[model samples]
Target: MRFSIYLNAQTPGPQEDVGIIQTLARQAVEATRAGFHGVVLTEHHFSGYNTYGDNFMFAAHLASQVPPGTKFSLAVAVPPLHNPMRLAQQCNLLDILTGGELIVGFAAGGSPLEYAGMGRDPGERHAQMAHNLEILEAALAKKPEDPPLEWETAFEHGTLHTRIMPSAFHRQSPAFARATQSDSGAEWAGKKGWYLFSAREKPQALAGRWRLYKQALRAAHAEEVVQDRLDWSMVQKQVYLADTSERAEAEIRERLVLMADNQRRSFGHVKDLRDAAHLKSVVGVSPQNPDEFLDHAMLIGDPASVREQIREYEAAGIRHMAMLFNFGFMTPETADRSMRLFIDEVLPAFTG
Candidate 1:
């Protein structure tokens, strides 16, 4: 099993932005020293849900400071909001800067407010994301002889002939992963040989999705493609460790509720019940008690208890666990303590 820090960088308000970035940077350095595999940065905008509006740029900056071996995972970049050529160029530069330590995750963003703010239609995001991804892949794979990529869309229309200079340090390109909720998304990812990114579902539900993904992979490709098993598939979860379970609850319980409320406010406009259910499964509903909230949704407890929870995920065939240690309005000191405790007590158990 491999562990990665999912950097939320959430603060109480803009007043604390600088402090939050410093704290996240400190933690990233500490995580590298502590033998963690990588760090995952999120992308969000126009809300307190997260503060990183341009995770790729932030990632590039952070990657320069972290150790050469520390990898970067873009949890999910919203491609529809970006020009595919520009996005690919920036990603390639980041990959080179990190010494090939980059993994790109793509997703059709969920927040309607964010879409509206960007002057884009939320309903058209899926198709737009698919199209952008196609262009991005082609741009990355383009050679000097290849013709310019020509396309027309509501947001962008032009011919892009410039190749991504200093092409990705990786032999091919950074490993590609896609965040998926529906069966079709899983099938698409599998057929394209991309890794899967999922969270919030129970182990049984995740197992079913993996099965479907594999079936699609087998259907679309040969036996060799289906036979390769890597731990690239990942799941993200909010995790906080303390000396005791009670302490962990006390530190993060209230903030968890606030986080849930923020989620509700941001995504409450979706009229479709199925979409609502999916959102609920991922973001979760507000819980009456801390235990109920942490039971299946998060990993919050003492080191021993947290170890047991991770064992369940490992058994479920999930090897990459993106752990979010800071969220909501939790203080940086509290987040730092939890991370240190996790590094000293919990991480060694798995790594050793």
Candidate 2:
């Protein structure tokens, strides 16, 4: 099994804006030193959901500071809002800078407000993302016999006779994953033989999705490819560890509520049907009990309790878990403290 820290750039207050970046950078370095396999950064725009609008740049900065083996995962770069060619170029540069430790994931972004702000139609995001993926895959192709690249979309129109410059240090593209819901997106990612990432879902639900993804992969690719990539999946969950369950609950309860409230605000404003459907799958209805919510949604407890909870996931055949430790307006100090305790007590049980 592998573990990763999912880093979200918190919305800093005006007075704290300058220092927040440095704080997050330090946290990334700390996570690396704490023996995490990788750091995954989320991307969001215009909303206070996240501050990392350009994850590639932030990842490159972190990569420069960390040792060569520390990997970087771009949780989900929105494809519809970017020019495919330029995005490929930036990814290549990041891969080179990180010594091939880059892992890229793409998604049709969920926020209608974000799409509106970018002068795009949120309803068309899936279609646009499909086209963008084609172009991106073509731009990153390394084989001489790969098909010629051609793209004609609202965001870009070009044909590349030559492969992208600064080829990835890896034999193929560094690594490609897709952020998928329990939707057609999972099947599409499986067809492409890409990795899978899901968030805020139960083990049973994720296991079902993984089964679907594997079935699709077998139908779309050779058996060898299917076998090699079947287990390259990750699930994300909010996690906080402390000396006691009571302490963990007291520390994270208010923040968890705040995080849910933030999601309500963002998802409540959805006007597009597609975004509404996505909101239904991700946020569902508002919760009445904070304790119940924490019990169901997050991993918050003492080291032994958290370890037991993670063991359930391992039993369900989950090989990678992305822990969202710095979320819901958590202070840097608290997040760091939780991470250190987890590293000291809980992580070794899994690693050893």
Best-performing candidate as measured by TM-score: 1
Candidate 1 structure quality by residue, lDDT tens digits, 1-352? 8898888865567898888887887888888778788889988887667776788888888887777788788888999888877788878888888888788889977566667667777667779988888888877887878888786665987776767676888665777788876668778889888778876656776777888888887888877756542366778888988899998878677777787677666666544423443434333423434565676568888999999988988877777888888887778888888888899998998898
- TM-score for predicted model 1 compared with the true structure: 0.88
Please give the range of 10 consecutive residues that has the lowest summed lDDT in model 2.
Answer: 279-288
TM-score per candidate, chains pooled: 0.88, 0.87
Clashes, model 1 = 0
Instruction: Provide the overall lDDT of each model, using Cα atoms, as 2-decimal numbers.
Output: 0.77, 0.76
Model 1: lDDT to the true structure: 0.77
lDDT score, residue 139, model 2?
A: 78
Compose the digit string of candidate 2's lDDT tens values, residues 265-302. Answer: 66666655355545433332233356656755678899
Error of 2 at 97 (Å): 1.7
Show model 2 residue runs off by greater than 4 Å.
142-150, 159-161, 215-231, 264-297
